[model samples]
Target: MTINQAIRILDPDTSAEALGEIEYYGGLRGKEKVLVACDEACRIAVEIMRQHLKE
Candidate 1:
């Protein structure tokens, strides 16, 4: 699925989790951690793609 769709799916899962550390973390925090996680993942993926292109 697309990133947006993946976010939609993850949003609930994050929210439904027991509040402890991540839930109240609060801008790319709390249940929104997925947003940042996705960003990092995308960045890594892009970097890997660029490396392959250089080779």
Candidate 2:
């Protein structure tokens, strides 16, 4: 996919929202918080990629 298409697929705002919710509910701190956020973001990006690839 083109860069624009990838950006649209990734949807940073949505990813931010997901991470915000995780942080709010998870109540994690410091390095643990960073790790969870990164993991969640990666999972979301991978899922989006997988869906687009299927189409």
Candidate 3:
């Protein structure tokens, strides 16, 4: 899937810091997964920011 597509799929699985290792230690090999995580994180962060701003 494209990065954007992965984002849609990934936006829900924000679990443990283990995901970080998948992104960092893996390096270039991990880029695709990292992008997936980042997209999800971005969507989540934006939702959180909006919630806080609304409050």
Candidate 4:
């Protein structure tokens, strides 16, 4: 499934761990961490949406 759409990257579940380095650095846990990461990743997606809306 999709996680970060700006990069059009899917959530690869083949990793050894679900939690990544960034979530650890952000001091987030579980669903909170996922939410935070999704929010952060959406910045560019939001910008692109805005650009399309203006066009």
Which 10-residue window in model 2 sums to the lowest lDDT? Answer: 1-10
Shift in Å, residue 54, candidate 1: 0.3
Candidate 3 residues 1-55, lDDT tens each?
3444434444456433545666677788776876666667677767767999999
Order the candidate numbers by TM-score, best to worst: 2, 3, 1, 4
Model 2 lDDT at residue 5: 36
Candidate 3 residue 51 Cα shift, in angstroms, is 0.5
Local distance difference test, per candidate? 0.52, 0.57, 0.62, 0.52
Rank list by lDDT: 3, 2, 1, 4
Clashing residue pairs, backbone N/CA/C < 3 A, model 4: none
Question: What tens digits encode model 4's per-residue C-alpha lDDT throughout 1-55?
Answer: 2434424322455222434544555573655765665565566667778999999
Candidate 1 lDDT over residue span 1-55, tens digit each: 3544334434656534423333456534655765555565566656667999999
Clashes in model 3: which pairs?
none
Candidate 2 local lDDT, 1-55, one digit each (tens):
3343334334775646544554676674644664655655567668878999999
Candidate 1 global lDDT = 0.52
Q: For model 1, which pairs clash? A: none
